[model samples]
Target chain A: MSQCLHQVAGPVWNLGRLNHVAIAVPDLGKAAAFYKDVLGAQVSEAVPLPEHGVSVVFVDLGNTKVELLHPLGKDSPIAGFLQKNKAGGMHHICIEVDNIKAALMDLKNKRIRSLSDEAKIGAHGKPVVFLHPKDCGGVLVELEEA
Target chain B: MSQCLHQVAGPVWNLGRLNHVAIAVPDLGKAAAFYKDVLGAQVSEAVPLPEHGVSVVFVDLGNTKVELLHPLGKDSPIAGFLQKNKAGGMHHICIEVDNIKAALMDLKNKRIRSLSDEAKIGAHGKPVVFLHPKDCGGVLVELEEA
Candidate 1:
């Protein structure tokens, strides 16, 4: 088994709660239309993140949000993921917490690997860190401050 | 882009809402321990589905669930998924709806593909269908009726 256990999201890895799920899509307009028209999620904001080379659309899902990712530049992480996955799909699952730094330190000390090594500004400009799926059983997870 | 749009989720494609995200772990007890003690997720029940060759433990998150999958028989789909996805991880995302047949038909009309032609009894023995990720951008989705 891996040496690290990321229990910082609190006892059961529960910091606050799920914030949103990011899905990588080839077409932002089509994905937006599906969630908005069919599923009834309201579009809160759509922003082009040049730094990440992706355009993001936030679809409000009542208690939470669903982020749709479409590549803006060929070099974007989402774009890279699409190339590797060869099928646009889920990017990562995000969770909200009270304290991100504390959680990161805890995860680090416990030996759980992190993708970023430090918190970065995420959607809504919130501080977030992504934990390696190796320590988390397979699913890529992101922890952020609410 | 391809022509298919909605019908991927079975007949209804009317995925009412996000249902649950399934995670696979090497040790069910240890993993379930992490989610329950840390995440504050209440453990509902541990069910075994011989047909699927897996056992499941659900961690409730309001209306949704975090399904923990552990392979029962060596030939289980979960076992194959684990072999393909080392370190275990999020296996699939489930969506709930009002009607299963209608959802399936809806997806068919959209030309979206399905893993199962009809809804089969799932972990809770509820009617459910797994949608092929090829239809969606990349995420494997499950459609079900509540």
Candidate 2:
């Protein structure tokens, strides 16, 4: 394994609740149908996000939501993922935080890398920033201002 | 983008809550420390599961838990993962369900494959069955009898 004992004081506030689990799917319609027709899940209509270059739909689970993501444009991040993983896969996970700016400062102080320099409006219309997966044990984590 | 329109006659019972998100880590102690000391989260003692060839610790997030897994033996399933990833990564996700047998049968009926034919005792000391990653959009899924 690897070795690292970097220490920093715990979060100034609670890390926050898990907002959603995002899944990258090549075909949005087919994936939505599987959740709806097979699992009997109530899925939302697909919303296109031109800024993020992705289209998304939320699957309601009462306590949480599953965000289905699909590439929207040529330079979409999901497009590269789909090229590598032909079928699709779990993309990233989002967690809600009370203050995005504070969280970003905390992460920066801890020497953590953020994918973006600043938080951008996400699918929920909330400011969100993505943490580098390399720092998160290979799991891409998103912190949404809640 | 793949095509799938498999329809099932809805589930007889609601799928239970998402129990935990499992992450495969190279160093269990270091990973646990990150969540505890960095995130200020409560973490459980590391527990070894000889049968599964892994040692695990649960980081409590109040509403949910993050299960950190490390290789326990040479033949451990996580060993190969660590060899390739070096820094570890998100391995699988477990979802709680009302009945394991019913869920298995439902999956079988849908032509979905399970990793094992029978449920095995998981770290939570509950009967758990793994679903094939290929069938779950490249994400390994575990269904625990709740």
Winning candidate number (DockQ): 2
Query: In candidate 1, what are the lDDT values of residues B19-95, reduced to their tens digit?
Result: 67788787788777766654445875668878888888887666466789999976888887788766777777777
lDDT of 1 at B94: 77
DockQ, each predicted model: 0.36, 0.42
Q: Which stretches of candidate 1 lie over 4 Å from their true place?
A: A1-14, A33-46, B1-14, B36-46
Chain B TM-scores across candidates: 0.84, 0.88
Q: What is the TM-score of each candidate against the true structure?
A: 0.80, 0.87
| Model 2: DockQ score | 0.42
Name the regions of candidate 2 deviating beyond 4 angstroms.
A1-11, B1-11
For model 2 chain A, where is the 10-residue window of minimal lDDT?
A1-10
- Candidate 2: Cα lDDT at B115: 87
Question: A1-146 in candidate 2: lDDT tens per residue?
Answer: 11132223433545777788888888889888766764556899999988889999888766677788999977997888788878777888787788888788777766779998888888778999999887777778888988
What level of docking quality does candidate 2 show?
acceptable
The number of the candidate with the highest TM-score is: 2
Worst 10 residues of 2 chain B by lDDT: B1-10
